[model samples]
Each structure stands twice: as structure tokens, then as C-alpha cells.
Target: MSEALLIAVLALPAVGAAAAFFPDRAGRLFGTVLAALAFVASLLLGAYSQPASWFAYTPAAQGAPPIVPWTSVDTPWVPALDLRLHFGVDGVSYPLVVLTTLLTLLCCLYTLWHVPTGGRGSTLVALLLVVEVGMLGTFLALDLVLFFVFFEVVLLPMYAVIAGWGGERRRHAARKFALYTLFGSVLLLVGVFTVVAAAGTADLVTLTSGSVSLTRNTQLAAFALLAIAFAVKSPLWPLHTWLPDAHTQAPTVGSVLLAGVLLKMGTYGLIRVAVGVAPEGARWASPLLGALAVAAILVGCLVCLAQTELKRLIAYSSVGHMGFVLLGVATLTATGIQAALIGNVAHGIITGLLFFLAGAVKDRFHTGDLAVLGGLRERSPWLSGLLAFAAIASLGLPGLAGFWGEAFAVVAAFERGGAGWVTLGVLAAIGGALTAAYFLRMLRKVTHGAASPAVAAPPLPALRVSGMELVAWSPLVVLALLVGLVPAVVLGLSAAPVQSLVEAVTP
Candidate 1:
């Protein structure tokens, strides 16, 4: 039943993508239903029974495999390459899989009511479904080559979404996004073959289990290739130039998915593949990685401070937010990995809501410039309130979804205990302050003042919230509160798997 659920999760979306071209409203409704079903299937993937104490913090027994998928399906795919149709999920990946499905459903539902210009609604929905399949497959894939295949699958469909249904600069943004990630994909392909060639197999479970011996030099090289590849997707520091442009020009749903689950592929790969498959390299590079993550945090916050455009500012914030997640992974401890996991889920929820609000603001005002927007509180109280809530939550307010990952990331770094790690922790804490400052600034500029010319302009549609918007945004709001109040929602499931991974990588 679990295996069937896995297959259903992937298959439903693929079929939906195909069915979405069936023309008009029928196709759009069909796609939305399939997306909803896919989300349900993903939820069920975690429903299988386990030992009563499976969530306990006890270490794995000696000689046990670091990763044990709760449900998996494996079959031969390419004999010559030793590849197979291997896919599985454990506590570590289940939350992300569910996140991908949920957000895709929301995006699909959003499309049903409001399709962006330059494309049919059905086509946009189709592209979203395709992206969902790639993301789900990437998370569930247990074979290295298969993982790479799924990773690359997301690139083109997302590119099409941006190019076909995005803003004025969409083509440029789409091209830049494509070129940047495709470069990463090239490196990713090389990294996959590097490990497969050296290890003589493509199974992630085997490679991560320490059954295959890789020398330090090989590990270092493979880790470099894989880390850089994932970094571009993570858009770490210097490699992140493409993201703001992509987000600035992408349509609402595009930005939401791009921020929501797409960036996660990189961080997830960093934890599950690069670090898991090459621990020696992760250790060797920890200081450098930690330093770069700090750089991203500070730089992203600084940039956000200077930004006038709403979406662009939010886009830059992701750099800092993801920096926290990467910092957790760089610590290479159970607390750190678990922090990173929750961070991934938290960022997806909060940022997805932010984009939804930003899109609505842009849609109504026909502008995203902070200079031209104000008095949201008076003009549209609910929208302003939701925006304030999302922004505060994003700034890492205590007792919200955003706090756990950033706070725990700092805690994990401190726990690592070297001078450099301590320094990274301290600087990251400062970045947290900078985060608050920029968000407050954004709120003051966009939501606090008297109505701007744009806001007060005549002939504008009523500021009243639409039912569709309420339906779409409510889940995110609830999730931000829910996950914040009960972090165990993500951390509980991830604790055991994270402990196992840390143990595997610990020298």
C-alpha cells in the first residue's frame, strides 16, 4: 500500500500534466484535482506503522544502515549503468515530499482562478504539475543517477513557466535562470558519474551506507563537484545572482514554487547526497562552507535593506533564509541537520505566503515598487494584516514557524564549538537582527503610511479580499502558526533519520 502510494504520488502528477492540455476549464479542473490527490497520496506515504519508539533520539545500532526508507520501490532501469528505478522515503524526506505536493496543489488551484498572461491557464497548470513531479521524484529517488535525472527534470518546465507566463522581463529572467541551473546540472551530471564511476554503483543507500570505500581524495573531489552543483541551485553567495532576477520577473505561482520547494532541492541534495555520500569532503570543507553561508546571510540581508521592489526584496531574503539552513548542514551534527530540515519546511510555508501576498499587491496596484505603495492597512486591512504576519514570522519572531530553524541553526553552530564555528554563529545571530530590520522597513514602507497615489488611484477594484485568495492563503497562515507552536511537526519525524546521517558522517 505504501509503495502504491509512492507510485500514485508521482504518477498522478505526471498524468495531470498530460491531461492538463485537454483544453479549457475541464483541463484546469482535472489538473487541480490531480494535484490535490497527489498531495493526499504524499500524506499517506507517512501513514505506515512503525515501532512505537521510532521517533526516539536513540542512536542507530552499530552496523545498521544510516538510511532506512519507510517505504520504497526498486527495480532495474538501465542495466549497463547499474541504475535502477530506486525510490524511497524516510522521516528525513517525507516532510519535503509532502511540502512539494501541498504547494503544487495550492499553485494549481491558484492558477484555476487566476492565470497569468502569455499562456493558457491549463498550460501553466500543466507546467506546475511537471515541476511537482520532478521535485517529488528528486526527494524520493534512492539511486544517484535517478536523483540526477529528476533534478534536471525540474529545470525546463520551470523555465517554460517563467518564459511563457511571466512579466515584462520574463524572457531574460527565464534565460538567466536556465543558463545558471543548467550549468549546475552539467556539474551535477559530472558529479553523479564521478561517484558512480568510482563506487561502481548508482544506489544512494549503498553509497551512503559506507559499503563502498572511497578514498579521501575521491571524496573531496566528488564533494566539491556536488557541493558547487547544489550551491548554484541553492544559489549560495556568488552563485545566487540569478535568483532575484528570476523571482522579480516570475509570475506569482512561479515565484511561490521557485521559492517554496525548488530551492530546497539544493539544500536537500547537500544534506542527503553531497554530505551523505562524501562525509570526508564535508568535514574538510565545513569551515569554508560555514563561512560562505554567513556571507550569504549578511549579504542577502544587506541587499534586502537596499531594495525598493517588493518581490525582489523578498527574493533576496531567501538567500539569507537558505543561508541559515546551509549553516545547519555545515555543522554536520544531528541538531544541525534537524534544524536544516525544519528550516526547509518553514521557509517554504512563510515565503510561499509572502509571494502570494506580493502577487496580490502587484496585481491590484500594477506595481511592486515600495516607493509607490503605502497605506495598505487603511486601504485593505486584511491584506495588510496578513502581510505583517508573514513578514514578522519571516523575520524569525519567537513562537513562529521561522524562529525554530534560524534559532536552532545558531544553536547548532555554537554546539560545534570551534572559534570559527562560534564566530559563524555570532554573525548569523546578527544576520537575524538585520532580517528583522529589513522586514520592519518593508512593512513600514508598504503597509503603514497613508495611501499612496497608486493606492488611492480611482477606478481601482475593491480592496476586499476574494474568497479564492482566502482559500489559497489560509493554509499557509495556519501552517506558519501550527509549525511554530509545534515544531515537533517536522523535527519529530526528522530526528531519528538525522541522527543516523550524522552518525554515518561522523569520523
Candidate 2:
């Protein structure tokens, strides 16, 4: 039953993608309906799915407990190489799966009212569905080769979306995006193969369970490969140059999904693949990872302060926000991993809202330049109000969803036990202050000022918030508030799995 649900969650979007070849209205309807069904299916699976193994495997060591994959599905696809089709979701993966489906559904709903300026609405929807398949499959996949296949599957469709439908510089951004991530893919492939060669199997569950003993040196080398790959995707500071370009160039829905589900893939990989399978390597690398995370936080915040374009600023903010997530992972404590998990979801919800608002602003003013976007409050109260709300939430205000992740990450870092981590924690807290500074500056510039000449000039179509826009954004707002008020909602889901993961490495 669980495997069937997982398959439905994975397959429905694919089927919708196929069905999207129909004419525009029909295709949009079909795509949205299918995405909605997948969302429901994901929720049901998370609520009721139990731990169970779909494939029979006897432990190599006598008296060892059998390893069961939650909501697992397995099938033999290769014999000689021992690769197989395996998929499952644990406590850690389930919320992200739900998040992916929810955001995809909202994007599809938004399309119903506003397709990109391009004519091929059907093709656009199909590309989104394809990206959904890749994201969902990545989170659910339990085999290394299968995970890589799903991971790579996300690249081309996204590139097509950007190149085919993005802004003036779309072509360059798309090409750069493809080149960077593909290069990262190469590193990931090498790491996957290295681990497979050492373990003699590609089963993620078994390898992470410590069934395959890996020496410290091998773990470090393999982890380095994997880290570089995931970092490009998670886009830790130096590797992050491609992201602002990609986000700024991509269309509204494209930016929404890119911020929402796509970025989580990298941090998810760090937890699920890099750290899960190579704890010793993780321990060795935690300091470096934490340092890089701090750099991302500081750098991303400072970049935001200097940005002229709203979307570009949001893009850079993701770099800083994800830094918090990465820092949580680097802490290597139970609370830290849990903080990373919630932070992943929080960044998704909060940043997705920010990008959506940024797109709306661009749509209204025909510009993303903050210099010309003043007096949003005078021109459109609805838009300005929402923008203010999202920006405040983003600044890690005490009761909002953003606060818990960074706060806990700082706490975890302080408690991570080492002089170096204590220093990192202090730096991270300073980064949080920088986060507030930039966001407050942005809010003042965009929402609180008199209308600039460009904004005072009448909107092209008498700009007002549409019903469809509200429909798309309402969930993000509510979830951000929900998670903020009751963080336990997200924190609870990953606690046990994170505890177990911490145990795996604690020795």
C-alpha cells in the first residue's frame, strides 16, 4: 500500500506531463488536477505509511535486525552491476516530498490564470511536471545510481524552462546553469561510483546502515566528491554565482519552483547521502563545512544589501538562508540535523513567498529595480502588505518560521563542542543580524517610500492583485505562519530519523 502510494506520488506528475500535450486549457487543467492528486497522495503516505521492506534481504551478519525501508518499493533492473530500482521515504524525506507536490500544484494553479508570455503553455507545464518527477524521485530514491539518475533528470527540463521562457539574458543564464550543474553532476557521479566500488552495492539504506564498512580515508575522498556536487546544487557561496542569474532570468513559476523545491535537493543530499553514508568524513569536514556556511551567510547577506533588483536580492538571500541549513548539517548533532531539516522546509516556504512577490512586483512595474519600485504601499496595498509580511518573516522575527531554524542552528553550533564551533556560532549569529539589516533595508526601500516616477505612472493594466495570485500565495503565507507559531509541526517529523542518523555517526 505504501509503495503504491509512493508510486502514485511519483507517477501522477509524469502522467500529467504526458497528458499536457493536449491544448492549453485542457493541458493546464490536467496538469493541475494531477499535481493536486499527487499532493494529496503524498500527505496520505506521510500520515499512514509504515516502515516496511519491499525487497527481501537477509542480513549478512547473523542476529542482526532486518533493515526496513519506510514506504519502500524495489525492483531488479540490473544483475551484473547489481543496480536496482529502489524508492522510499523516511521521516526525513516525507515533508520535503509534500512540499514539492504542494509547490508544484500551486505553480500549476498559477498557470491556469497566467501562462508565461510564450505561446506553448502546454510545453511549459510539461517541463514543470518533468522537473517534479526528478525532484520527487530524488527524495524517494533509495539507491545511489537511481538517485543520481533522478538528480540529473531535474537539470535539462529546468534549463529548457529558463532558456525557452526566461528574461532577456535567459540564454546565457540557462547555459551557465547547465554547465555548472552538469559539472557538479560529474563530480557526484564520481563520488557515487567511488562509494559503490568500495561498498560493492549501490543500496543507500544498506550503506548508510553501516552494513558496508568504509575506511576513514575512502569515506573522506568519496565525501569530498559528493560535497562538491551537492554544494553546487545547494550552491554554497563560491559555487553560488550561477543561482542569482538563473533565478533572475527564469519566469515567475520557474523562480517559485526553483526556490521552493529545487534548492532543497542539495541540502537534502548532504543529509541523506553525504553525511548519512560517511559520518567519519562528515566529522572530519564539519569545521570546513561550517566555515563555508558562515562565508555564505555573511556574503549572501552583504550581497543582498548591495543588490538593485528585487529578484536578484531574493536570489542572494537564498544563498544566505541555505547557509543556515548547511550550518545545521555541519553541526553533526541531533538538534543540529533537526534544525537543518526544518530550516530546509522554512527556507522553501519563506523564499518561495519572496520570489512569488518579487515576480508580482516585476509584473506590475515592468522592472525589478528597487530604485524605481518605491511606494508599493501607495500603488497597491495588497502587494505592499504581503511584501512587508514576507520580508519581516524572512528577517527571522521572533515568532515567524525563519527564527527557529537559525536560532536552533546557533544553539546547536554553540553546543557542538569545540572552540572552532563556538566561533562559528558567534559568526552565524552575527550573520543573522546582517540578515535583519538587509531585509529591513529592502522593506524600507520598496514598501515604505513615496512612489517613484516609474511606479507613480499608471500601471499598464491598472495593476491589482488577482484571485489567482492570492490562490498561489496564500498557502505559503499560512505555512510560514504555521511553522513559525508551531515549529514542532516540522521539527517533529524529522526528529526520530535525525536521532538515528546522529547515532550512526556517534560511535
RMSD per model, one decimal: 1.4, 3.8
* lDDT scores in order: 0.92, 0.88
Tell me the TM-score of each prediction against the true structure.
Answer: 0.98, 0.95
The runs of at least 3 residues in candidate 1 whose Cα sits more than 4 Å from the true structure, single-residue gaps closed, are: 49-59, 458-461
Error (Å) of candidate 2 at residue 286 is 0.7
Model 1 Cα lDDT, one tens digit per residue, 11-51:
99999997556886778899999999999988777776243
lDDT at position 266, candidate 2: 94
The candidate that wins on TM-score is: 1
Candidate with best lDDT: 1
Residue 107 in model 1: lDDT? 90
